[model samples]
Target: MKNRNYIHLFANCLITKGISRSVICDLQRSKYVLIPNSFADLFSKQRYYNLKEAPRIFDQENLSIFHEYVAVLKDHNFIFSCSKKELKRFPQLQLKFEYPAKITNAIIDFDKNSNTTIKDIIQYFLIPYNCRHIQIRCFEDMDSIFFDTLITEINHCFIKSVEFIIKDSFEQDYTQIMKWVENNRKIKSLVLHSSQENKVIQKENYGFGIVVTTRQKITSESHCGIIHPDYFNITIESYTESLCYNSCLNRKISIDKSGNIKNCPSMKQSFGNIKSIKTLDSIIENPDFNKYWTISKDKIETCMYCEFRYICIDCRAYLETPENIYSKPQKCGYDPFTNKWKWDYESFTK
Candidate 1:
C-alpha cells in the first residue's frame, strides 16, 4: 500500500552535512555513520518520501544508488517505514539542554610542587553549586596515599563522577588502582598517560575503567588538544549543548598546577589564583571568565563546515591562528572539504 510505503529517518538520526560527505549521528546509540553528500541532500529535500515517488526523483542510472542507500539505511535502523499520517507522532529532536548543576564539570591540575589542597577545593565549591564532574590531572607520578586521601574526601562529597589522569610510571600501583575503581561508583576513568603500551582495562561492573595511552607526555597545558575519532562522544546531551555552547569550555572551570584559576588550564589568561580567590564564586562570576563559553562550533572557522562539529570535542586553547579566537584547532588534521584525514583513517570501523 502507498500509505505504508513512506520512509523517514528517526528524529535521533542527526544528518550533519560536510562539503563532500555527511555524518549520520545516532544519538541513542552514541554512534555515527558516514554517507555521501548526495544521500544527505535527498533525505533533507524529502523528509518522508513515498517509495512509489522515487522513480520521478532519480534517473535510471542513479536510481540504483538510491535503492542501495535505502537498503543500507533500513538495515542500520537509521530509518523506518511508516505512513504519511503517522509522521506527526514522532516530533523533531530537542536541541535545548539544561544541566542540573551550576558547574557541570571542573578540572584540577596537580604536580609535586602544587600546594592547593582537595579540602580547600571541596570547601570552596561547597554543595550549593554542585560540580557534577571533576577531572584531576597529575603531571608527576603520585603515591598511593594521594589517592587514598582524595577518595576519602570524595566519599563524603556530592560530586557525581571523577576522572583521574596521572603520569605513567614503571611502578604503578595497579592493585590500588583496581581496588579504588572497583569500590567507588563515582570513579569513572583512570588514565595513565606517557605509557610504553596502549591498552584498556575495564569490567562490566566498573566504570569506564583504566586506559593507558602512549606518547602522551602531558607536562604542561600545551599538550591539551589532539583531535582523534576515539575522543568523539555522540550523545544527546553533548549534541544539544554543542548547538549553543563551546563543546569543551562551556560550564567548565579549572585550577592549574601553579594554583592559577582559569576557564581552561591550557588558556594563558588566569582569572585569579586559587589561594587568593574565595570559594571560586568571584572568578566564575567575572564577565571575562565566561567570554569563550559561548563560542560554539557555529562561530568557529573551519569547524563550522565539519560534519563532526557537533560530536567532536573542540579546543579553543590552541588555535591554528593563535591571535584569532575563532581559528580552528591546530591539532585537527581532518579536512571537511576533501573529506579526508591527513593520516590513514584505519580506526574507522563504521
Candidate 2:
C-alpha cells in the first residue's frame, strides 16, 4: 500500500489523568470530537450548569461534587481534562483505559503482572458485553501442554479472535503454534514480538494468513505487516514505522500506557479516568470530553508544517514530558519546532 493509505485519525485522551466534563464541553463547543472509554451511564444522572451561573453549586471544600457534574458530561465519549475534586465525585471510577465499541479487537502487552490480571478481568467483564476480539500475552518457554490447555479454555470462552505473542528467544517450536492456529480458525491475527528469524518465516511458510511484527527489527520487506514502538516519527530512512499503516488506518480508538491520555501516546495531559466510571457508555455522552478526537493534526501548529507529521505517530507520552518518553525515539532525530537535532546537525544530515 501507499504511505498515506494507512493514515488514521486517533482519539487521544486518557480518563485517568484528570480531565473534567466542563472542560470537555468547552472543547466540544470549539468543534472537537472525542472517543471516551466508557459508554454513557456514568454521567447520565448529572445536569449541566454554566460555571458563572452556578458559582456556588459546589462548595470549595467539596470540589469532587463539581467533578461529578463534569464527568457526567464525559459520558458522551468526548475528550477533556478534569481536576482531583471533580474526579473524586466519581469514586467508582478507577484509573484505567477503555476502548470504544467500534473497536472490538485489541492487542495488549502484559508488561506487568497487573497487566496480565487486567486482561482476565477485561475478558470476564466484557464477555457479557459481547466484546468480539482479544489477544493475550504468552511466554514461549511455557509448556506445550499449557498452550494446548490455554487454547482449549479460550476456545470455550466467548471469543472471536485470539493471538499469542511469539518471542524471538523462546525454546518452543513455532510449528506447533502454527499448527494450533491452523486448527483454530477463531484466531484471525498473529503477532511476533522481537523475532528477527521469524521475519524470514512469513516469507518461507504461508501457514500464518496474517502476521505482524510488534518490535522494531522486523520491517515491511519481511511482510510482517505491523510494527510497534509506534510513538515515534517516521522518515524514508525508517520505513518500518509505517507497519501500522493499514492496520490502524480507519481506527477511532487509540490506547497507550501513558498515565495521562491525550491525542497521540506522546502527548501530555488527559481527558478523564476510565476506572472512575466503569462503563464505556459513561464516556460517550460527555460533551466536555469530545473535542480532542475532532481536532485535526494540521490544526495543531507544531504538526502542520512538519514534513513527517502525516506519517509520524504523534505521541502524548513524549509531548507530556519529553525526557520520560524517549531519549531517542526515531523521530526525535530532528526537531521541527527548533529545526535542530538533539545531537549534532551535521551527523543527522549526513
Candidate 3:
C-alpha cells in the first residue's frame, strides 16, 4: 500500500441517528444533511482506514454504494483522510453546553388590552436581566406612540437580538414599520402575520427580514412548534444543548398577553403577574418553574428515535399525549421510521 492513513470526521460534523436514517449536522456551517442508516454504519468500526480494510466496510457489490456515500461526505467537507500519526493529534469537539446568563432569552406578548405598557416592561424586566434574545408578539395593531417609545427604550436594554411579531396594519403604511425595524441594529426579524399577501422582504440595512404570512395570525403561543425544516437550528451551542437539555424551555421565559409569566406563553401555569412579581430571580429559582428544563429529546418518546432530535427544537407544552410528560410533540409530522417528512392534518393539534 502507498501512504496509508486513518480517516477522521471534522470535529464539527456530528452525526445523530434515528430508527432508519441519520442526520449529519454541520455545526460550523449551520446546515444539516440526512443520510441512510446503512451509510452511517461505515463509521461503526471507528478505526484506522486503509485499502486492506476497505473490505471490512463493504463487499464487492456494495463497494460502489460505499464510494457514493464517501463522495457525498467528502463533497460536504465532513470528513478528511490523514496519516496514522496525525490521527492522534486530532481530538473530537467537546460537546458541553453552558450559558453565562441565568435566563438566556424571553418572549413577551402584547394584545390590544394588555395591562402593562412597553416602557414599564423595559424598565422592569429587560433592564434588570441580562437576557440575550427576545421576541415581542403584538396580537393587535399597536399605538404609534407606544411603538415609538419601545424602540427608543429598547436601545438601553440588555437584549442583544429581537424579533417582532405583529399583525399587519392597514391603517398605516406597513413599509414605515419595516423602516423602523431596518434601522434598528438589534431587530433581527419583523414578522407580519394576518396580511393581505404572503411575501418575504429583505432589502438594505433596516429591512433585513420582513416576513409575511397570509391568512395566518399568530395571536398566541399555541402557534409554536410548527416543525418546519426552516425553523431548525444547526448551531454548535443549540446542537450540544439539545443533547442534554430541552431546547425550547431551557433558560427561556415567556409572558403572555394577560401579563402571566410562564416557561411558554401557551402553557397553563404562570409564575406570577408581571406587575406583582417582585423579581424574576425568585421565579427562576422555584423548582416548579424549571421542571421542564431538563426534559431533553433523548427522554421524549418517538422523538428519542428521530435522527433530527438535536437540530429540532422541542415543545413541552403541546404534546401528543398531554398527560405524559415524555409525550411526542403534536406539531411534529415527521415519520422517522419511514425516512420522510409529511404534514398530517389530523395529527397536528393546533
CA lDDT, every model vs. true structure: 0.81, 0.38, 0.78
Model 3 reaches what TM-score against the true structure?
Answer: 0.92
Question: How would you encode candidate 1's per-residue C-alpha lDDT over 1-350 as one tens digit per residue?
Answer: 54678888899988988777889999998889899988887778656667887898889988998899889888888999998788778778878978887678888898888887887887786355688679999877887688778878887788777888888774544665676677876777878887766666454344455545554566777777778899898999999999889999888888899989888899989988878876767766788888788899989998999999999999988888999999998888898888778752233211
Clashes of each: 0, 67, 3
RMSD of 1: 3.2
Candidate 3 off by > 4 Å: 1-4, 45-51, 203-213, 344-350
lDDT of 3 by residue, 1-350 (tens): 43545567788898898899898889999987788877776665662345456677678878877677777878998888887767777677889997787788889898878887666766666556667688888877877676676667676666677788888774436667667776677787777787777766554355345544455766666777677677789999999999899989999888899999899998999989988974788888899899899999999999999998999888888888999989998888888888676785335544
Best by TM-score: 1
Question: Tell me, what's the RMSD of every candidate?
Answer: 3.2, 19.5, 2.6
Ranking by lDDT: 1, 3, 2
User: How many angstroms is residue 162 displaced in model 2 relative to the true structure, after the best TM-score fit?
Assistant: 4.3
Cα lDDT for residue 107, model 2? 38
The 10-residue segment with the lowest total lDDT in model 1: 341-350
lDDT score at residue 197, model 1, on the 0-100 scale: 69
